[model samples]
Target: MLRADGIHRVAVEDPGSLGARQHLRHCGLDTPPVPVDTDGVRVDELRATGAPAVLLTPAHQFPTGVVLGGERRRELMRWARAGGLIIEDDYDAEHRYDRPPVPALRSMLPEHVCYAGSVSKLLAPALRVGWMLAPPAYRDALVAAKRFTDLGNAALPQLVLAHLMESGELERHLRQVRRRHRRRRDAMIRAIRAHLPGAVAHGAAAGLHLTVTFDGDFADAGLARAALAQGVKTQPLSWHSQRPGRPGLVLGYAASTPTDIAEGIALIGEALRRLGP
Candidate 1:
C-alpha cells in the first residue's frame, strides 16, 4: 500500500505493534511513532505526523491491549476517505474472553483498509499460513510482492488448514483454547495482584498477552534483565516504545500453565524488589 500510494512515511502506535514496525523498516519506510491511550492509537497524534498512511492493531492493540473506540474508528475512516490509508493488522481478534466481539474496521470501510490475518496464532506459527484482503487498487501489487518474497507459503499446510476450517474443527479448537487462555489470563491477573502490588495490567479482556505498567523510577530494561537472570523471560515495555513513559513489561501467558504463570510473576516481583523503585 505504501508503494502504491507513493507514501514513503507511515505512523505506528508508540509501544505498539512490533511486527508492523519491523515490516515498515524492512521496506525502508519511515515509521514515525504515534502515542496510544485508553482508546487505542491516537488519531490526533497520527494526523500531527502528516504521514499518508498508518498501521494499526485496533481490535486488541499489541502490548497495550486498548481497542479502538467507536468515535476514533469513525475519525480514522474520515482520515482514510480524505486520501490517507490504513493498514489493519487484525491480530488475535478471535480470543475474546470478556465483552462482545468488536467488529473489524475493515467491515465498515473495506476500500481504505488492508486487512491481514493468520493461523499462526490460531494453530501454530511454524505453519506460516495466512491470507490478506486488500482493496482492488493494491491487490495485484500485494500479490506480486508476496510472490517475490518467498514464492508464496507452502501449499500442504494451507490445504490442511482449509480442511480444518471446512470440517468446523478449527472453530472447535478455538473454543477449547479460549477456555484455557481465559483461565491463564485470570491466573496472571491474580498473580499480578498478589505478587506485584502497584502494577496495573492492561488489555486483560482479550488477546494472548497482557501488558503491565508500573508507576515508579525503576528502569524497565534493567528489571527485565534481572528477571531474565532469575530464569523468568519478559519483554520490557520500553523495548516496544519509541517515546518515553512509565516502566512496564509485556508478558504472554498463552503457553504457560497457571502454576508457571504464578511462579514467573513472583520471580518478576522478586526482581523488582532487588532492583528497587
Candidate 2:
C-alpha cells in the first residue's frame, strides 16, 4: 500500500523488530533508523529523519516494550495531521498485564493512521489471518494489493475467527491466557532476580517477552549460544538494533511453564558465569 501511495522513505524504530526492518527493505522502502527511548520512539528524531511515514509498535514496543507516552502520542497526532502517515502495528496490545488498556493511534486519527493487527500474537500465527485499516484514499489500493498478493486469505479461517470473535470466545481465551502468561512472567522475573542479578529487565508490563540488558560491554551472543547448546533458546539484543547498544537477551515466557521459565534462567545464569568477567 505504501509503495502504491508513493511513500518511499519510512522512519523505523531503532532496536525495534529486525524482522520489520528486513520487511521494509525487502519491500523496497528507504528506512532510516529512529531511536527509541524509555517513553517510546523519539518523535524529535523521527522528524529529523524527514520521512513522510513512520512504522512503529506503540502499544507494547518490540524488544524493549515501552509504550509510546501521552505527549508523544499527541505530537504524533499533530505530525500525522500535517501530512505525515503513521503505520501503527498494534501487535500485542491484548497481552498487557500490569496496565490498563491503552488506545491506538488509529483510534485518534483514522484518516492519517494505518492500523494493522493480527491474531498471530493474540491467538495463533498458524491462523495466518490479520487485518488492516487504511485511510479512505488508500483503502481500495490496499484491497487491490491483497487481491494481487494471495487472492485474499482463505475463507475458512476468517469465518472461524469471526465466529470466535462474535461469540466472545476469543476474548475468553485471551482472558485465560493473560492470567496464565502473567504467572509465567512473574516466574521469569523471579528467576532473573535470583539467577541473573546483574541483569535489568525491561518491557515487563506487557508482551510475551522481556529484555534484560547488562551494565558493562557484554557478550550476549556467546551467552545465547551457550544456552542453546544446553537446550535453552535465547535472542541477542544486538540482532534487533541498527546501532551498537548494550548486551542483552530477549526471552519469551508465553508458552513456558513457571518451572521451565525458572530452569531456563538458571541455565542462562550458568552460561553467563562460564563466560566470566
Candidate 3:
C-alpha cells in the first residue's frame, strides 16, 4: 500500500506469495507480476515492470529454495544503482546445512534496500520482534508510520531482547537451534524420499522448511486440506502464487519433533494416496 501511494507499479515475483499481493491490493496498489529463475527474481522482467522498486527474498526464495546466484546479485546491484528500490526480507537467513550463509543484500546496497528481519523463526513468533533498516530518505516516514501504528513495539520484550543480545544468549540459542534444526531437516528430507518419492524438494540447504512439488492432478490446496484432516498441517504452494505455478507443499520441520515430522510426512503420503495421487 505504501508503494501504491508513491509508485505507479510494484514488481512482485510471479508464482510468488499472493499474500503479499493481497496486502498491496488492500493498500490500493497495483502489482505487476515478474518472473523468477534459478537465481531469484528475473532482473530484466523486473526492469520491464517499469516500477521503481521490487520485493525479494534473495537469501532463500520462499518456495523454490533457490538462492540468488552470483551474476544475479551483480545484476541486482546494477539495477539498484539505476535507482531501483529493493525490499529485502531476510527470512530464515541463519539456518543452513549444506551451504555457507549468504550475505544480506542490504549489506551491499543498503542505500537502495529496505531490510526487514524478525525473530519469528529464531525464538518464536509470539515475540513479535522484527527490525527494519531503510535508507535515510524513508527512515523518518517509516518511524512516523510505526509511531502511529503502535507508539513503538512493546518496551519489555524489546528490553529483554536487548539483554539477550548483550549477554550473547541469543547467539547461543541460535547455535543450539541450528544444530537441532539440521537434524530435523535431514529427517524431513528422508521422510520425503521414503513417502513422497515423486516430489521435488527445494531450499533444504537452509531454513526450517522444505518446499516440495509434485506432478499430480490434485490441487495443492486440496492436498493441504486432506493433510490437515489427517492431523497434519502444511501450506499449499498455491498460497504463495501471484500467478499460477505448480502443485506443491511447504513442509516446515523446525517446530516439529523428528518423530512428528516422519509421522506427518507419512500422513501426507496417505492423504495423497486417498486422494488418488
Candidate 4:
C-alpha cells in the first residue's frame, strides 16, 4: 500500500528489524527508528516520528519474546487513534509456550491495524500461505497489490488451507506443533543454561526461535559469520538492530531435533569461546 499511496516514511523499532528497514528502503521508503521496551514499540517515540504508518509484531515481539504489556497496548491504540496506521505481523502467535495467546491488536482497533498471519512457522515456510486482515480504507488497495503481485496466491493452496481450517485439521496440527515446539524451546533453554552461561536468552516463552545476547566484546555479526563458517547458520542480533546495542544471535530450534539443538548451541558456545580468552 505504501507504493499505491506514495507514503515514503515508516517508523520501526530501534535495535530492531534491520532486514525490514532494508526491505522498505529497497522499495524507496525511509524507515525511522523507534525505541521498543518491555512493553513494545515505545509509543511516545513512535508518535514523535510523525510517520503515517508503522510495522510491528505485537503478539510476540520479534528478536525479543516480550509481549506488549497492556498499558502500551493502549498507547498504541492512542497512536493509531490519532491517525497512525499499524501493520501488525502476527507471525508466531501460536507457538507460545509460557503464556496464553495474546489477541491481535487489530481485533481491538480494526480500522487502525493491518493484521497479517501465516502458516509458515506452524507448518513450514514452504506453505507460504499467509492472510492479511486490513482496515477497510486500505483493503481494496491491498487486494489490488495482491492481485498484481501474484494473482491472489495459488488457488489450490488457498483451497487446501481453507479445507484444513474448516475440517479442524489445521487446529489439530497446530496443537501438535505447539507441543513439539514447546519441547524444543525447553531443550534450547536448557542447552543455553548448560552451554552458554554468560548469554542471556530472550523470546523463548514462544516462537520457533530464541534470542541470546552476550555481554562480551565480540561483534555479533562476526560471531554469526564464524558460526556460518563452522557449518552452523544463525542470524546476528546486530543484523536486526538499527541502533547500536549488545551482541547476540537468533537461533531457530523448530526445524532441528533436540540432539541438533544441543549440538547447535554447543557449536555457538565454541564459536563464542573462540572469540575470547
Candidate 5:
C-alpha cells in the first residue's frame, strides 16, 4: 500500500513493531523511529519527522504493550485527517485478560487506517491466513499486489477458516486459550517478583508477552545469551530499539506451562546476577 500510495518515507515507533520495520525495509521504504511513551507513539515526534505514513500497533503495542491513550488516539486521528496515513497492525487484539477491551484505531477512522491482522497468534502461523482492510484509494492496488504475490494465500485454508468462524468454533478456541495464557502471564509475574526483584514488568495487563525493564547498567544482549546457554530463550529489548535505551527483555508466556514460565524467568534472573552488580 505504501508503494502504491507513493509514500517512500514512513515513521515507525521506536522499539516498536519489528515485523513492520522489516516489511517496510524490504519494500525499500525509509522508516524513521519515532519514540513511544506511556501514552503511545509520540505524535509530536512523528509530526517533526514530516513522514507521510506510520505503522502502529495501537491496541497492544509490540514489546512495550502500552495502549495508546485516548487523547493520543484523537491526536492520531487528527494527524490522519491532515493527509497522514496510518497502517494499523491489529496484532493480538483478541487475547485480553485484564481491563476493558480497547477498540482498534481502524474502527474509529477506516478511511485513513490500513488494518491488518492474522490468525497466526490465535490459531497457527503455519496456516498462513490473514486479511487486510484498506481504504478505497489503496484497495484495488493492494488486491493486485496480493494477486501478484504468489496468487494470494491457499483458498482451501481460507475456506476452512471461514467455516470455523461461521460456526463459532474459533471463538470457542479463543476462550480456552485466553484462560491458559492468563495463567501463564500470572506465573511469569510471580516468578519475576520472586527471582528478579527491582525489575519492572510492563504490558502485563494484556497480551501474550511481558516486557521487563531494569535500572543500572547491564548488557541485555549478554543476559539473553547467558539465558540461552542455560536452555532458556529470550529477546533482549535492545533488539527492538533503534536508539539507546534501558536494558530489558521481552518474554512471551503464551506457549509455556506455568512451571516452564517460572523456570525460564528464574534462569533469566540467574543470568542477570551473573552479569554482575
Candidate 6:
C-alpha cells in the first residue's frame, strides 16, 4: 500500500523493536529512527522526518510499555488526517496486568489507521493466524497482495480461529494466560530486585517482558554476549536504537518457569560481574 503511494520511508520509534525494523527492511522500506520517550514516540521528531506512514505499537509500547499520551495521540490523529497513514500494532495488548488495555488508536480513526493484531500472542505461535484492519482505500490492494502471497493463510486455521472467537474460547484463553503471565511477571520482578542489585526495571505494568537498566556507563551488549555464551538469551537495549542510550536488557519471563527466570537473571548478574565495573 505504501509502495503504491510512493512512500519509501517509514518512521519507527528509536529504541523500538528490532524485529519490526528488520521486517520493514525486508519489505524494502527504509525505517528511520524517530525518537521515543516515556510518553511514547515523539510526534515532533516523527513530523520532522517527513515520513508519510508510521508503524506503531501504541496500546502498550514495546520495550517501554508506555501508552501514547493523550496529547500525542491527538497530534498523531491530526497528522494522519492530513494524508498520512498509520499502522497500529497492538501486539500483546491483552496481556496487560495492571489494567484493561487502552482503546486502540484504530478505533478512533479507522480511515487513517491500519490496525494489525494476532492470535500468536494470545494463543500459541503455531496457530500463526493474525488480522489487519486496513483503511477502505487500501483494502482491495491489500487483499490482492495477500492473494498473490501464499494465497492467503490456511483456511482451516482461519475457520478454527473464527469458531474460537465466536465461542468465546479466545477470551477464556486470554483470561487463563493473563493470570499465569501475571504470576511470572511478578516472579521476574522479584528476581530482578534480588539478583540484579543496581539494575532498575521499567515497564512492568504490562507486557510479557520488561527492561532492566544498570547504573553507570555499563556496556550492555557485552553483558548480553556473556549471558548468551552461558546458554541464556537476552536482547541488549542498544540493539534497537540507532543512537546510544543506557545499558539495559530486554528480558521475557512469560514462557519460563519462575525458577528458570530467577536462575537466568542470576546468570546475567554473574555475567555482569565478570565484566567488572
Off by over 4 Å in 6: none
- Runs in model 4 deviating more than 4 A are 3-6
TM-score of every model?
Answer: 0.97, 0.97, 0.95, 0.95, 0.97, 0.96
Local distance difference test scores for all models? 0.90, 0.92, 0.86, 0.85, 0.90, 0.88
Off by over 4 Å in 3: 1-5
Could you list the CA RMSD of all candidates, in the order they appear? Answer: 1.1, 1.1, 1.6, 1.5, 1.1, 1.4
**Local error of candidate 3 at 30, Å?**
2.1
Per-residue error for 153 in candidate 4, Å, reads 1.1
Q: Show the colliding residue pairs in model 4.
A: 65-203
Error of 5 at 39 (Å): 1.3
In model 3, residue pairs whose N, Cα or C atoms come closer than 3 Å (at least 3 residues apart or on different chains), thus clashing, are 16-240, 17-240
Number of backbone collisions per candidate: 0, 0, 2, 1, 0, 0
Clashing pairs in 2: none
Q: Candidate 2, residues 98-205: lDDT per residue as tens digits?
A: 889799999899999989999998888999999899889898888888899998889999999999999999989999999999999999999999999989999999
Candidate 3 global lDDT: 0.86
Better of 3 and 6 by TM-score: 6
| Candidate 1 vs candidate 4, lDDT winner | 1
Give me the candidate number with maximum lDDT: 2
Residue-wise C-alpha lDDT for candidate 6, range 90-160, written one tens digit per residue: 98788888876788999999999999999887777898798899999888999989888888788888899
